[model samples]
Target: MKRALITGVTGQDGSYLAEHLLRCGYEVWGLLRGQPSPHRSRISRIADDLKFVEGDLLDQSSLVAAVDRAQPDEVYNLAAISYVPMSWQQADLTGEVTGLGVLRMLEAIRMVSGIGRSGTTSMAGQIRFYQASSSEMFGKVREVPQNEDTALHPRSPYGVAKTYGHFITRNYRESFGLFAVSGILFNHESPRRGREFVTRKISRAAARISKGLQSELRLGNLDAVRDWGFAGDYVKAMHLMLQQGNPGDYVVGTGRTHSVRDAVRIAFETVGLDWSRHVVCDSRLVRPAEVDLLCADPKRARAQLGWEPTVDFDELVRMMVEADLERAEREQRDVARAPTEPEGDW
Candidate 1:
């Protein structure tokens, strides 16, 4: 079986990608910064199926060690300080892990493969690399729908860092003859999405309010729009990028845009709750520099990769809301089952 190494294996995309690769008969190795037990929840179903390699993006030596140990046929670097708002709060950390981290991985691969050396042949046995670039790179978009050729004008520190990672991935491909490709993926969500993200936040809150567990949902600009796709579908594009004859950047998205308000409405409706009753606009939740709109021109991904999103916006929202509702119900059941203190003081 082919061996593959995945960084950020605990994240939504990483978990989906790991499951995908495993189903394809690839022996997957996940890069873990610390103890594996703490991060097992995301990939618990496939945790035992994966080999964990201890490493961190902040440290080059650890990455080199990971590469040496895994000796993977393909490497997917998905680890990043992915939250856009958090990027502002921890700009330096984001730069270190998200920006410079790509460089370290590339260098590690170069050292391990030795493909770019004077006597070494470039095509022999080199690990293919995929950097998870973001649509946020098109902060102040120059066009209606962005594609691979779109110019990057990153606004947040996260987007700026992702831009650096994107360029450096291409640079290594050209300068060092590495098989490196960057996928400029648009906003993709799943039931596993963290609550910090708007889509998940809306879904979880809708579920909680429906269950009488939460009182209100505070959100930022409800008009901000994004091109969203299912995480499972996008991860397929990542694998497809590596299987191609040539290495190049590709934009992966659903080609459909939805606003934050649209997501809220769909999610609340899924839970049989009126969103307006519980949803409240909080100015403090707004970004320091907001990206009003982001939609993808995914013609390249469709025509080239033979890929299309199976889940639409409505389906995606309902999926998440239903998942959260199930969780809330489970929690309620557990609370009811727990033992209570005796009526009399003990």
Candidate 2:
């Protein structure tokens, strides 16, 4: 079995990608910073099959050891400090993790060529690299339906860091003749989305409120738009990129956009509630630098990978809300015997 390594196994996309690669008959290994959380629910169906190894993106020594130990045929660099507003508070750390982290991984790969590291098993030419670039890189939206060729004007520190990761992937491919590809994925969500994000926060809170478990849901910038797609479908595009005869960057997303208000409406609509009554827009919740619009031009992915978003916006929202409701209802029903824990902290 070809070994596949993912850097962010705990994340939504990484979890889905692990499942996809495992189903494709690859032995999956994950690079994790620490041990698994006992309270956290895993989205990856093949969690038992995935081998997790401790590694840190900021540490070159750890990455080198991880690469050597995993000896992966393909490496997916999906780990990043991705939340935009949080990036403002942790700007420098975001740069270190999201931008320079890619550099550190690439350096580890290059060093495996027997250039710098002693007694390192070399497979630099054989390992394929996949970088999880984002549509956030096109922050402020110079042009609608942002494509691979679109000029980037990133508005947030998160976006700026992703842009660096994107170009660095290109640098590795061109300079080292390695099989490296960048997927400029737009906003893709699923049930596993971190509640810190607006969509999941909306759906989870709305579900709780419908169950009489919460008071109200707060949000900001309901007018900001995003081209959201299914995380499952986008993860397929990442795998497709590795299967291609030649490596190239591809834009992976649904070719449409929806306002944040639209998401709130759909999410609450799923719970059979009027969102206008419960959604309190707090001015403080707004990002200091907002990415006003994002729409994806996914023609290249369609043509190259024969890919299109399988789930539309309405269905996507429904799936998320339904999952939230299931989770909340189960929690309430089991409360008599179940051990109580604090709310999900990050």
Which candidate wins on lDDT? 1
TM-score for each predicted model, relative to the true structure: 0.96, 0.92
Reference-based lDDT, residue 314, model 2 = 92
lDDT of each: 0.92, 0.88
Task: Give candidate 1 misplaced runs (Cα > 4 Å).
Answer: 36-39, 116-121, 339-346
Residues 162-248, model 1: lDDT tens digits: 999999999888877788999999999999998899999999999989988889999999999999989999999999999988888
Q: Measured by TM-score, how close is model 1 to the native structure?
A: 0.96
Candidate 2 lDDT at 234 equals 92
Candidate 2, residue 203: lDDT: 84
* Least well predicted 10-residue stretch by lDDT in candidate 2: 115-124
Question: What would the per-residue lDDT of candidate 2 be over residues 26-115, giving only the tens digit for each residue?
Answer: 999989887565313564466778897889998999999998888888999999999889899999999999999999988777666444
Q: Candidate 1 clashing pairs?
A: none
